[model samples]
Target chain A: MTVSDIQKLLNAKVLSCNEKLNMEVTNAFASDMMSDCLAFAKDANVLITGLCNPQVMRTAELLDIECIIFIKGKEPTDSMITLAQNNGICVLMSEYCMFETAGILFKTGEIGGATVGC
Target chain B: MAADNTIKLHYDVPNDDFTRAGEASSDLKGKLKQMGISPDAIRKVSIALYEGEINMVIHANGGYIDAEISENGLKLVLCDTGPGINDIVQATQAGFSTALEQTRMLGFGAGMGLPNMLQNTDDMIIDSIVGVGTTITMFIKM
Candidate 1:
């Protein structure tokens, strides 16, 4: 599915880098820990994270995550938005919590992106 | 410049600027992309190096990051003079951290930094002296 589709399914608002809305994303990885994302994440197209911080954007840059969905109604800071724009990573905000968002995405066809363990 | 076909880059990590902690890693990431390195290698090196960069800012005040990109692999050396770790083994264990609450709130200090570095790279060596400082060297085959 395209990032735009995920945004529509979750009713998420685009927080930054609107240019990538049409980018296709086949898998999503959810994590609050950047280390887990770093160590085990392989080619995860979308990152569903509860943590809202600059490091999340940094993690996205390293893993080449095309899109980031901030769950639990979290909003991106101005710097985070700038970072996302500069790196060409799309940022989205969802009102649903991490569990609900992951469930919705998984039920909708997004597979588990990363491996099971670190 | 030192050896055949090896591109070397260095950056002085600033201690006072937490926001700029990962600049060196980011710069190196961009350089690797420009050089047409494999995406998998670039991702591993970038993430592993960034974790070390963050560790330097949070624990060691600041440090120096040296990146040597050779034809076969990438070498990263991060050196810091801050108070060194007491136990190297314990520090590498998951979920063991000595970082302040402020650092954790910023999405770090979970004690997975070293482990993450080790996992991403092909080889990693960490040397520390309790009263002196610490230096970590890592290599990733491209």
Candidate 2:
């Protein structure tokens, strides 16, 4: 799936990197804990999180995640937007809560956990 | 152990500043990407070093990071003067953390930092003194 698809599905607003909305993302991981996200988020291109700290952007940079979807109307600060822009990551904010967002994406088959062996 | 081809970078981590914890790692990631390093290698180095950087800020008050990059691999050494880990074995275990409750609220201190570091690197070594400090050396192969 793509960032555009996620935006349409969740009715999310593009906070940064709007030009890259068409970018393709294969998988996603939803978590508030940066540690857990860092440990198990292999090959996941989208991060669904409620944490608004700069570390979220840092984690996305480290993992090469393409987009960050902040749930429950959580907005990212200017620094976070600047960081995401510098890293070429798209930031989206959704009014839905974390659980509902994850469920919607999963039901649409646009996002899911890490896939095991081929 | 300095080689002619090595590119070394250094940074000093500040205490209790969760907002700025990953600056060093972010800088290193950009440098590696500019050098045309493989994405896989860069990802490994980024995750491993970033985790170590966060650990330094969370556990060790603050610290220093020295990263040496060569054609073959990247070597990252993080040294801190904070309270040292009391148990290396337990510390390496997943879900075992000593971080304050406040730290956890910021979406960290889940006890996966060390394990995540080890998982992303080719080699790792930890040395610590109870009251002196802790130093972690991690190598990510290119």
Which one wins on lDDT? 2
Q: Across residues B1-142, which tens digit of lDDT does each residue of candidate 1 receive?
A: 4477788899999985777877888889998899898888888888899999999999998989888888769989999999999999999998899999888777788888998888889999999998799999999999
Q: Write the per-residue lDDT of candidate 2 for residues B68-136, one digit (tens) a residue.
A: 887778888899998998999999999999898988988889999999999999999999999999999
- Candidate 2 off by > 4 Å: A115-118
Model 2 preserves the real interface contacts to a fraction of 1.00
Model 1 stretches with alpha carbons more than 4 Å out: A116-118, B1-4
Please estimate how well model 1 matches the true structure, expressed as its whole-model Cα lDDT.
0.87
Query: Scoring only the second chain, what is candidate 2's TM-score?
Result: 0.96
lDDT computed for candidate 2: 0.89
What TM-score does prediction 1 earn?
A: 0.93
| Full-model lDDT for every candidate | 0.87, 0.89
Docking class of 1: medium
Alpha-carbon deviation at A4 in model 1, angstroms? 0.9
lDDT of each residue in A53-99, candidate 2, tens digit only? 99999999888888999999999989889999998999999999999
Total clashes for model 2: 0
